[model samples]
Target: MLPEVNATRYVTPLREGGSLPGIVEADNHGTYVVKFRGAGQGPKALVAEVISGELARRLDLPVPELAVTHLDPIVARAEPDEEVQELIRASAGANLGMDYLPGALGYDPVAHPVEADLASRTLAFDAFVENVDRSWRNPNLLIWHGDLWLIDHGATLYFHHNWPRAGNVAQRAYKWDDHVLRPYATNLATAGPALAAELTPGLLEEVIALVPDEWLAEFDFPSAEQARAAYLGHLRTRAAAWPAWLPGAAA
Candidate 1:
């Protein structure tokens, strides 16, 4: 959805991304790993990731820089023609584009040693607010050059499954008692201010405006302006309700 996503940049397929991933060179002069889905993921998934990633970055989380990208088919065909590779390139920007992380390693919460308690708490807040895309098998958290990076947000909010009619009240009630959320909730208050400041009116508007018009139509989320206001409200409430038990809770 970013206006900056260059459609003409030749996206070269990288052989490695498990499935549906094509690594491409971004205009920003950084290597990007992208996962594309022709008709399966739909544009909304990409939209959610872009929006949320930007939002998280604003919240002072360790999310990597990201953008929406279009893959060039000719470049894709240049590869050896593997099924997954072929599919990934064929599905380019229409489905996904990611800014590649250099010197990063995958991480599990239990195994990570740098215990920045506030970072953990903020990430959990993200799960509660966004109905996150992570799980046990694919936590999607990466350790790049000694820093943690969040990825694979394509499944968060599960909007595609619920959008036509978020009719079920249950759908709105994400279980915050899960392993990740339960541990972090205690620290939400201290982390809340930094996160709150990140969701500034300007930042929210800038991100919402990036949503591609095509994706907006397909996903049927609230209108961009309305969606922006709603997201702000959601963050505000989270900030207000942050628990006082966290480290540096006085913040």
Candidate 2:
């Protein structure tokens, strides 16, 4: 579980970020890297980060610790930067934010280890099932202090728009041989029990609420109601159908 840190204390802006990410330092002097709502990518992506990111973590995949941060730009001003001052000022009244990934550098999938391969496949499985936001070029994998870290999950399960009112349950077909998917089918199957354990209705509801109401306008979800229904239904269907061909299916 992540401790609630006051975002005003340690959230400093990254000068190079297109979405204006910040360095989040807690009172215990622990640090994390964060991306905020009013910054670069906007609310929809942030919503995806919290919702999909948390769900993936619950599935026992290798995801960095994440938390929703409430920030005060005035406190953020103390971090000291000529450029970030403008960004912090520009963003106010936004509570939708995430804890940062510390000591991580982005990398290509081929460069990572076999464990990294398993993690990526599990991620792709989650993406395929949910119609996710990750891709080969934009895998969002980070190498932090010698370990692989997964980040930026704002783009998964995009099928809500295609059939918003269709069903409370959706079964979108996925290409098993996708560059990332083919290699990790076995890993995904192995991880199914953990994934199944976490996909409860209560958890899904809480994840959905993490998205601020204002972000609905940016989402392509047909109508707000339909989008919400479809997104939740998609996850449920995916969880129900956890691949059966796993090595130890009887276990």
lDDT of 2 by residue, 81-148 (tens): 76677666655544444446555677665676546346545644454345333456455667777776
**Any idea how many clashes model 2 has?**
11
Q: How accurate is candidate 2 locally (lDDT)?
A: 0.57
> Where is model 2 poorest over a 10-residue stretch in terms of lDDT?
242-251
Query: Residue 181 lDDT in model 2?
Result: 37
**TM-score for each of the candidates:** 0.71, 0.66
* CA error at residue 122 for candidate 2, angstroms: 1.4
Q: Candidate 1 lDDT, tens digit per residue, 1-251?
A: 45345444445555444445666665567666775655356666666677777666666667766766666565555556567545755464454566777677777667765455555555544543455545444567788877767676666545345543433321243444443424434555545455544545566567656766655554445565555455455444443444432233344
For model 1, which pairs clash?
Answer: 32-100, 69-93, 70-93, 71-93, 104-144, 105-143
The numbered model that scores best in lDDT is 2
TM-score for candidate 1, please give it. 0.71
Indicate which candidate wins on TM-score.
1
